[model samples]
Target: MHIRVYNTTNAFTSLGATFDERVLLGRGPTSSTIHGELRHRVGSLLPQQGNDASYAQLYIYDPASALEVRNCRNQQLRRDVLQTIQDTLLQVNPFVEKFR
Candidate 1:
């Protein structure tokens, strides 16, 4: 699988990595801000406009640290991509609190 990690600090130039399986190896410290697709099936999980966008992402909250912001195109898979993102990345499983 191919993974691309981008940092808002320098989004123009991104770091790319490849893996043989579906796993998160956790890229560099800059990867604290993560964004990208899962490779093979990524194209299938996207809106017509965002089809070219990535599915996976990594980043951090602190600009001084690794990863900063992550943006995922709405794939509209079995689950709500927004909710999936909130749950997967933000650890907001129920989303009962964040909605408030």
Candidate 2:
């Protein structure tokens, strides 16, 4: 007799999605702000390389409700959002390599 075991408990979970600002707003002033803010926020989330262009809109959809935070005017709120995301990610093991 042969048997196999598959572990499905720890699976990669995607937090959300982001799209370049230009894709939505073309060429505009907000694009610049989005780029700068995205760099700051995402940079903290992951290692940043170079200064090309990371301008994007953040959309987080999970745990029932969805959240969308734009602009860097409210530094505190942006920080809070980033912290929340980081905390959540820490709590969940999104990347799992073993299936046994």
Candidate 2 has a TM-score of 0.22
lDDT string, candidate 2, 22-56, tens digits: 55566545432232223223333222575222212
Error of 2 at 66 (Å): 22
lDDT: worst 10-residue window of model 2:
1-10
Among all windows of 10 consecutive residues in model 1, the one with the lowest summed lDDT is 1-10
lDDT value, residue 77 of candidate 2: 48
Task: Give all candidates' CA lDDT scores.
Answer: 0.30, 0.30
Candidate 1 residue 10 C-alpha distance from true site, Å: 19
